[model samples]
Target: MSIQILNLNPCYDHWVIISKPPKTPNVLRGDYVVKLVDGKGLNIARVFNTLGFKDYICINILGGDVGKIIHAKCKEDGINTLEFWIEDESRINTAVVYEYEKRMLMVNEPGPVMQRKEVENFLEFFSSVLKENGTLVVSGSAPRGFGIKDMARIARFAKEKSCRLMIDISGEWLKELLNFEPEMVKVNADELRIALDLQQMNLGELLHIKDSYNIKVLCVTYGKDGSVTLLDNRAIRVKPRVIQSDYSVGSGDSFFAGYLYYEALNKSIQERLIFATACGTANTLKYGAAIFDLQDLESQLSNVDIMEEEL
Candidate 1:
């Protein structure tokens, strides 16, 4: 079975590095500038392409001229894309990288609000292209018109087709998707706590709820501290080699892509978790989102340590 990515909410992302904005009417000079598609699934797909993994397809919602730009970029990367057109233009998200502050300021727009017809059209398109027994990746925030219940419907549809559903989302939508029992879930520590409505908890506490749903794996990323994964009733903590990085916007996507890569190769579970963490750590060294240098990844991979933990 092939790999398929469903990222309904996509945006044209623009990144710029500058000192500061001028108060007077003057042109602000940027040290560097980049414009590209921004969506978690697309980020993961880029890693797939980088690793020369073919037979993968990405589907996203698009509209207006911005949509065309995303499509063109995907084509340039040699990624097969399925675009669903809507009436409203897709949103533009901008990130200003402050050289001195060493942090990025993000300004995001609410994506296109789907009409009833557009939603129906998307469902039709998803059903027509979805592959059976394939890996179904659903990621990113939703568009303005989509809600948790609507997302739950998609999860149910994937389950009906016997697809391995993997979701990387947050908030109430994450709560709703949990009901369908996805095969895999990757969330940040904050997102995991928020989803389970806990002040402080461990894998055991979360597993109390997930056990009933039969989720195969639950991964929680704790940024620099590393990540923990629960699988086969074993919880393991993965530590990565720390490296100086320009930005961390796409680390999670790279991690997920690495997990999928090893999964397709039928590697041991321990190898998958460690490789995923290394990919995430390697992504921080670059400016472009989801970009990973194989040399860096391989170097980091050797340092990735997996420690079995008491759950």
Candidate 2:
């Protein structure tokens, strides 16, 4: 079977723009634009689709009319979607743009809370689809009231099915789920700092996560500084390739997709990290969450510098 990735959480959105920041007793004065879809997992799915990979998305879709619109957009993109319908409408995250000051502010909704039965149904659906010898990616945040135990259950199920699981999450959810022993975990520097409960840990200190968990890989993305991957007591640091960036949103997801694509092809870990960095840098050249072409990625892969060190 082809590598199968399952996205448990997804969102539909309306990205709006405002001329200025709202003050006390704020009133609307600017344009209110609505975008059809937005979510971390969906973004990853988009990138994968562009990369010509066969993948599936599993999401609990809510709301009435808007939910249909979201599903329509996904179908238009040729993305395979498996949805669980619910009572409330999907969320709309607003991005307020202050054109004069050249600043942008985003306000996100908490989304609808999932009932106990809804959660159980989602788990059962996921367990049935999961297959051994395939890879599963569980990304993004869970709805409120969903705890780490839920994550642990999914991770454990994937493990028993002999599927490689990769997670990208932050805060208490990430802290609690680390005990489940995923195949790989990715987080930004700030999240890493908070999870370890330290202001800063040197390279040596950062490598300790591998010793503590049976995790095969731990990747830390450092924005313009590029990223570092720890595997089997060796750390490889990849420097950012010079590229003009229009937006940084979804760059990490693109990187993860790139790494996993190469990994599923059985590439070495070093090669995987190099391709991952190239994918991330290539994303900087495009607007929104657009994916980089494989031909372009292959051309740029040689330019990426990977420095390896042993801890």
Candidate 3:
């Protein structure tokens, strides 16, 4: 079976912006440009497609005009989407800003609530797809009424089927699921602080979680400070590659995608982390959640510095 990504929650969007920061009233004197597309899972699927990986996106689709637009966009990207349609319209998230300020203010809609049937259907679909040993990535936030335990449930199912699960999430949701012991957990610095309840813990204390869980890999992304990966009884730190920032959105997802791609090939954890960071840096060179080009990724990989630190 091909690697399957079960994106339990996803979105559609219309992005509008100004090239420079607005001085007063935070209003730009230009046309409100609108671009519509699938959100998180779609972005990850697109990157996987660009990297020539076998993948599928499982999402819940609500029926409406916006849903039609989302479906159309997913088709354009060649993403094989298995959607569970419902009564409500899909949500629309917006990001508004001036490019020069290097800051974006976003307006997000609380997604539609899933009925019991919707959730059950998604679980059935996800389980059927994982009959064989393969990689399963469950990322992003759950909708209303769904808690971190939901993620743990999926992880549990994957575990029962002998599928490797990689999770990218934060807060209590992540904390609860850690008990399930995913194969890999990716957490950014801010999330790490909350997960370990370490407002004052040093790097050593922060790195100790690896010993406490059945997790094979623990990745802590430090934004511009680079990223640290703990694996095979060692912590490997890689400096972030410098690049002009077009937009930081989706960089983490891209990094995870890149990491998992090379990982599927059985590369060393150090090599995987380097490629992952390189992919994230490459993502900043483009606007929106654009796919990272392979050549650019390869070039950035050369500049990535990886060092093993004593725990």
Candidate 4:
């Protein structure tokens, strides 16, 4: 199956592993650390690779020295990447994790602005690559100077191309996409709350949105409580077999990627959702984001409980 991924806002994710905290306020060196090209797009790509799916094509906007590193890393991973170069330096996002302390602190940078020519270039490339029966995943946040109209245009183009679209974004970026009715939407509870302007994720409202927009599937994730996937007439909940996690990042992306894997196989909704939950739980067992071996995932497959939830 062909899946095209767009990471409009990419970043060099610098991870600082906290080993020993200083007794007093003083400088303490990290035990071990690493940097990875991240943001939802890249994370999904990583999971896809872990699962041995190599057909995904990623289109990302990169710039500056960090962008160079991102490109080199993607190449090293053997992923098919198309880089759109910009003038501004790409952003650096840091994640400090104190696993023993069960504490994690993340500092994120706003991404660079995309020029008019850059937007046109991306559109041209996207149009050239999109084909019938393919999946287009527009993920991550819009960069600085990116407007809602630009996002709407991309969704419209995907719709016109007759490619199935999956949305994993929030707020105004998502508000604009709703007009075009993507085939599937993956939003966490917080994202759903913000996108729908509600204090809670009301299942009825989610169903209404699906019916009103002609969306086929809407998935909302709740951190430890599992997730609910809503269809036109029914809703299903997929619960993880194991809840313990060390790495705090990439579970959502792993779930989405896993779901995409099953979707590509034309699996039933229940199998897709169950396998997605299994992937997320297996990912948590690994230290890094979206990192899981087949052994870990296969072991967890028996634990995921899929049940029908009343909408």
Question: What are the runs in model 2 whose C-alpha is more than 4 Å off?
Answer: 14-36, 55-63, 96-103, 290-303
Clashes of each: 0, 2, 0, 0
Model 2, 229-262: lDDT tens per residue? 8888688999765755545666888888788777
lDDT of 1 at 204: 67
lDDT of 1: 0.83
Tell me which of candidates 3 and 4 scores higher on lDDT. Answer: 4
For model 4, residues 41-118, the per-residue Cα lDDT tens digits are 888898888888888988888888988988998899776788878888888898887766877788899878878787
The TM-score of candidate 3 is 0.89
The TM-score values for the models, in the order shown, are: 0.94, 0.85, 0.89, 0.94
Query: For candidate 3, lDDT tens digit of each residue in 1-311?
Result: 35676665567766676775557684565336656464555667877887888655545445567777777887887777776666666778887756667777778888777777766776676667665577777777766655555566788888888888778887887887778777898878888687768766456665667667778888888777788877756788888757667577788888888888888778878888888888888887755664568887777888788899766
User: Residue 234: error of model 4 in Å?
Assistant: 1.5
Could you give the candidate ranking by TM-score, starting with the highest?
A: 4, 1, 3, 2
| Clash pairs for candidate 1 | none
